[model samples]
Target: MRQYWVAPVGPFHTADGTAYATSITLTDVSPAPQITLPANMLEIGSEIELEASGFFSNTATPTLLLGFYLGGVAGVALAASTAVTTTTAAVAWPFQLRYRGVVRSIGAAGSIVGQGRLYLPTSLVASTTRFIPETAALRTVAIDTTVAKTVTVGAQWGTSSASNTLTCQDLSVRLVT
Candidate 1:
């Protein structure tokens, strides 16, 4: 069996006095319905995007691990937030992780903000962007159909402050093969 999944498309405009509609076809082999793989297993030479968002706030900030895992025992780790600290305040954190390669090249980024002391004892603000270099030797581990795997994208609140609120807005995996 095969399936063609078309995602939502709209708001496409032609402002140059010329407009055109284009379509691309994607093919996929049918797999178990209960465990749906957006495009399928993480094949070699494939690119995948893992997106996730969440909200967090704390009165007595604590350490947090917001990341995504792509395997079981041996796998790739796409971290959106690593050892992020929550202060005595409320803030929303959203993140995205990307993996592309024959051997996988992984990267991650997100919105980070805080009031007063956070992450560090001193005030600091920096962007978080990481990418693995693409090379001939690059390789990404695949999900073994026979064994269990842990491919999850989410945030883990280590401890609670006065009001520690952790909410996951969205989590999705898209394949760009």
Candidate 2:
């Protein structure tokens, strides 16, 4: 039998008028939301899913980076998307990012393999959304499942400008066993 668990982290939404121009560990509400994976919480075939939505505006086209971390924004990287260059400037574009990973092993040598994708709007006037696929080859990450782990997501902008801002509107994490 399979069981599912929703991490008590978020549906975190950023407050209006709050945006970040530099790389940041995203937090809109008080205290950034994080998923706590307890020791031995994962077994072989266990899976995790992370989803987020946000808006971005740029003065000039800049490369955007999104990543998943084990502890916090500065922690060990589990997976990251390749830098994606924006196509438009001075326009508020909405984006959705999602990642799914499955545990391949457990114990001290526990590992998971995952991939992520980003959905970005090419134009506000047009009904087209650009699909930015994660370019990194899927690989196993060594995570010690015998100890508790914290997970977080972060965003970075290649160029810093007042007009170049990003805000995470929502984020959620889930686990399946």
Candidate 3:
């Protein structure tokens, strides 16, 4: 049997066009753009899909790091992207990311295997958006499926600057089985 659940919360985003500034440490792009998965909602073969889009601008070619977390910003780490150096400076570039995770087990020691890709622009040209695949060899992480889990995405800049800012415009989560 198969089932699906569209998240009831959002398509969430930052409020009032507020953009999150990057620091040397990772931080949530938008605290409000998170989804909570109810306890026992996942089983073997169950899958989760997360889609997000945002715009970023930098004054310097800083190294950017992105991560997915199972709790809040400081919670259990699910996956992290390899450091990507910004190709351009002072240009507002738009990016999109999609992540998929499948439950491999269900329990306090449950696990999920996942992967994702980022569509990042190298320039203002439409065709310049490059597909940056997650190069992690193994993204299997232990999770507690018996309790509710909040998922969020975060980012950091290797070199912090006031001009190095990012704003998440949209985020959606879906459940499938």
Better of 2 and 3 by lDDT: 3
lDDT of 3 by residue, 1-177 (tens): 745665534545455235767478787774464578889988898888877677888876888876667776687666666678887574778877777888999999999988777776777655233232355445788899999878777788888788888877766777776
Best by TM-score: 3
Model 2 per-residue lDDT tens digits across residues 38-147:
88888888888877676778866777776666666655557666566876574767777777788999998778888766676666644233332344443467788898
* Candidate 1's TM-score: 0.47
lDDT of 1 by residue, 69-116 (tens): 544112444333345554445444433344322323222211111111
Ranking 1 against 2 by TM-score, winner: 2
Best by lDDT: 3
Q: Where does model 3 exceed 4 Å of error? A: 1-18, 31-33, 126-136
- Give every collision pair in model 3: none
Number of backbone clashes in candidate 1: 5
143 in model 3: Cα distance from truth in Å?
1.1
TM-score of 2: 0.77
lDDT-best of 1 and 2: 2
